[model samples]
Structures are given as structure tokens and as C-alpha cells.
Target chain A: MSFHEKSNLAVLALLTLVFGVYFLWLMPQMAVADPLPPPAAVAGVLIPFVLCLVVLIGVVHLVFKLRDLKEKGEADERDRLIETRAEARAGFMLALGVFGALTLLLAGAAPFWIANALLGALVLAELVKGVLRAIAYRRS
Target chain B: MGKGKTRIANSIREQRFHAGEMTQQQLADAVGVTRQTVIAMEQGRYSPSLEVAFRVARVFGKPLEEVFSYEDEA
Candidate 1:
């Protein structure tokens, strides 16, 4: 795999782990049998903490890998083209998600729902960009 | 995945072999590309831009047509 593809895979794994831990494990555990669920402020702090931890781990791992390879990181023309196309697709996905979030807010959805929707959209956009880049690398 | 859909084919691998068995990394360094890009071009999985194509041809001291050719699929 190219460095970019490996980097994308690392990021994808990190996002999956972070979101899975936050949504499926942490959030559910926080509300179990509790009459008063924790405030959004608690969630906000914990989520950022978890995200930071995961991102740090990913950066450390990538750094080690790069050291082992002894590669001076540089993207060539093909990489640029793939990134350009992937970002274009991801940009559209992000715009649509943000618009959907706005619509939900206009329809009087809860603040929590709007926030989650917007966050989910942002994550999905990054995920889409990574997935499309990996696919383009393979298919091309 | 098949040659039918391929728009271009190249003899980079053969040319590199003739040029004292040059490594893909060497070619990539000479042509200002990543080794992975050179690998893709050699495998006919990706076509380079016109500028990159010219660079590759120049490295091999050959005409562009000698290194790459367009294919029209009917």
C-alpha cells in the first residue's frame, strides 16, 4: 500500500474505534438505569477527550511507521489527483449533511439531535474521503 | 480490470529493464513521482499525465510513443 492509503486506513480505524466507543459503549453506559442522564456538557468533554486520545495514538503509530520506512513524505501527481477527486465527493456529502442538520433545526428538533446529526455528518464526510481515496488507489 | 477498458498501455517495465535494470524507485526519483505511481504505470493500472509521460520518455532517452501508446476500445 502507498503511504497515503496506509494513512487513510489508520484514520479509518481510529474513527471507527472512537465513534464506536463513544456511541455504542460510552453513551449507552452513561444512561443505563439513570433517572437523570448526564448533561450534554459532560458528553461534550468526554467525547473530545476520547477523540484526542485516539488521534494521538494514530499520529504516534503513523510516525513510527514513517520512521521505519525512512520516507520523506511527498505526494506525487497521481496522489494529488486522487485526493482532489476524493475531496470533491466528500465536500458534497458534507454540504448535504449540514443542510440536513439545518433542516432538522428549522423543524424544531432537539439541540442534542442537531448536534449529533452535524457531528455524524462531519465524521461521515471524512470517512467518505478516506474510503474514496483508498478505492481510487486500488481501482486505478 | 481488463485491457478492453484501458485507455493507454506503456513499456516502462521493458524500458527500465533495458536501461541496466533500473529500479522503479530510481525511475520515480528521476521523473519526480512516487515509486507507487511508477508501479501503477508499469502495471498499466494508471496512466500518467502528459508532463509525467514526457519525463518518463526523457529518462529513457526515447520518444513518447516508444514508451506509451493510446488504445481505442470500440
Candidate 2:
């Protein structure tokens, strides 16, 4: 695999693992709550989660760069095209997710639920983008 | 009209063979693309842009028409 493909795979794996654990922990609390958990409680979890994710992703990319020093170059035309197409599709996914979150808000859902819904939408959109890019790279 | 049904066909592989058995990576470097892009083009799974087409033709010292041909699948 090219360095880009390998890097993409690594990032995708990290996103899945990190967010998967986060949602698994948060979902149970959400279900048991009347409307939503306290914002402070959610923020407490989120701050650390974001910090850890950034650090982990940074380390992963550093390792990839170190391993593939020769493969490093600016993205060429094909790479740009693949990324553009993937982001376009992911944009649609984000739009759909935002619409759903807005509907929840209209129904008088808690701020916590809306916030999480938006966050979930963003994460899912990113996942979709990553998967599509991977497929494009494979087929290319 | 469908995926993988591109009307454009290329003689990149044959040209590469004539050009001293040029490796895909070498051609890609000459044309400023990734080796995977070169592979995709050779396999007819991808169609490059016009600029890239010209670049590839130039790399092999051939006209664009000699390198790439269009098939009217009407």
C-alpha cells in the first residue's frame, strides 16, 4: 500500500476504536437518564476524550511518516479528486445528520441529546469519508 | 455511462514496454502521479485528466492520440 493508504487505514482504525468506546460508555447513561445527562458530566468526559484522540492520532501519523519517509509528497491530482469526491458524499451525510438533530430539537429534546446527536453526525460523516476514500484508493 | 465503462483506452503499458521496459513507478514519477494511479490507468479502471494525458504522452515522446484513443460505444 502507498503511504497515503496506510495512513488512512491507521486513522480510520483509531477513529473507530476511540469513538466506539466513547459511544458505548455514553449510550448507557443516556438511556437511563430522563432526558439527558448533565452538561458538566458530558463535558468532563468529552474534554479528556478529545485530548486523548488528538494525542493518539498525532502519534500514529508520526509513526507512519517515520516509516515511509521516502513516500512523502504533496497529494497529486488523483489523490485530490478522490478526497473531493469522498468529502462531497460525506457532506451529504452531515446534512442528513444535522436535519435529524434539528428535528430532535424541535421535539423538545435536551441540549445534551442535541449536542451528542451533532457530535455523532460529525463522527459518522468522517467515517463515511474515510471509507469512501479507501475504496477510491483501492480501485484507483 | 456506467462505472468502469470508460470509453477512453490507453496504450500506456505497451508504450512503457517499448520505452526500455519502464517501470510503473518510473512512469508515474515522470508524469507526476502515484504508481497506483499509473496502475489504475493501465488496468482501465481510471481515466486521467487531459493535463495528465498530455504529460504521459510527452514522457513517452508520443502524441496524445497515439497514447490514448476514444471508443464510441454508441
Candidate 3:
């Protein structure tokens, strides 16, 4: 696989693992009795910590890959074009997701639901972006 | 911008072979693209931009038309 493809896979895996684990941990708490836990108390600290760890791992992997392949010919015109297109698609999804979240809030959903909806939308957007990137690499 | 089909085909593979059995990586470096991009072009899976197409032809010391051809699907 190309380096960019490998990088994309690693990022997708990291995002999935980190957020998947967070959601699993939050599930029981989310079901707790009324007066829902403050979003910060429940996930704020853990989210940042886990995200930092995942980002660190990705950066380290990329550094090593770059060192191993000094002449990696990183991200030429075609690669850049593919990435731009993928991000544009992902951005559209993200906008729609946020708008949906706002609609839910306006319709009187709990703050907890609104927050989770936003998070879900963010994750889905990133996932879509990563998947589209992988497809572009393979097909184009 | 569309996917799954291309109107351009190229003989980059044959040209690379003639040029001292050049590797894709080397050609990509010379043409300012990734090796995978060169592979895609050779397989007729991805069409390069005009700029990249000209660069590839220049790398091979040939004319753009000599390296790539247009096949209208109309």
C-alpha cells in the first residue's frame, strides 16, 4: 500500500478505536437517573486525553515512515486533488449533521442528546472522509 | 471529477521500460508525483491533469500526445 493509504488507514483505525471506546464507557453513565451528568464530568477530560494519545501514535508512525522512505514523493497533484474532493464531501455531511443537531435542540431534546448527536455527527463525518480517501487512493 | 471511468490512456509503462527499465518510483520523482500515481496512469485507471501529463511527457523526452491519448466515450 502507498504511504498515504497506510496513513489514512491508521488515522481511521485510531479514530474508531478511541471514539468507540469512549462511547462504550459512556453508555452506562448515559443511562443513569435524571439530572444527567455534566458532559464535562462524564467525558471531557477522558476525551482529550485519549485523543492526544491517538494523535501521538499517528504522528510517531508517520515520522518513522518518512524516515524509512526518505524519498517518499509525498502528496503530489493527484493526491492533493483527491484529498480536497474527499474533504469537501465530508464537510457537506458535517454541515448537515450540525443542522440536524440544531433542529433536535430546537424541538426540545435534552442537552445530553444534543451533545451526543453532535459527537456522532462529527465521528460519522470523519469516518466518511477517511473512507472516501481510501477509496480515492484505491480507485483513482 | 467523476469516478469509475477515464477518457485518457497512456503508455507510461512501455516508455518506462524503454528508459533503462525505469522504476515507477524514479519516474514519479522525475515527474513530481507518487509512484502510485504513475501506476494508476499506466493502468488507465486515473487520468492525470494537463500539467502532470505534460510533466510526464517531458520526463520521457516525448510529446504529450505520444504519451497519452484521448478516447471519447460519446
Q: lDDT of each structure?
A: 0.80, 0.86, 0.81
What is model 1's DockQ versus the real complex?
0.49
Candidate 3 per-residue lDDT, tens place, A32-118, comes to 748876667657645785777577667868675877766463787777888899999999889988999999989998777778778
DockQ order, best first, reads 3, 2, 1
User: Candidate 1, residues A36-121: lDDT per residue as tens digits?
Assistant: 34346547656685768577667866785767575545788888989999999999999999999999999997665577668778
Please name the candidate that would achieve the greatest lDDT relative to the true structure.
Answer: 2
Clashes of 3: 0
Fnat of all models, as shown: 0.52, 0.48, 0.57
Q: Which stretches of candidate 3 lie over 4 Å from their true place?
A: A43-46, A53-56, A63-67, A71-73
Cα lDDT for residue A55, model 3?
A: 76
Model 1 chain A worst lDDT run, 10 consecutive residues: A30-39
Q: What digit string (tens of lDDT, one per residue) describes model 2 on residues A1-140?
A: 76677777887888888889889876666658876678788888888888888999889888877877777556878788888898999999999999999999999988888888898999999999999989988766
Candidate 3: pairs in clash: none
- How far off is residue B21 in model 3, in Å? 1.1
Please report, as a value between 0 and 1, the fraction of native contacts recovered by candidate 1.
Answer: 0.52
TM-score of 2: 0.92
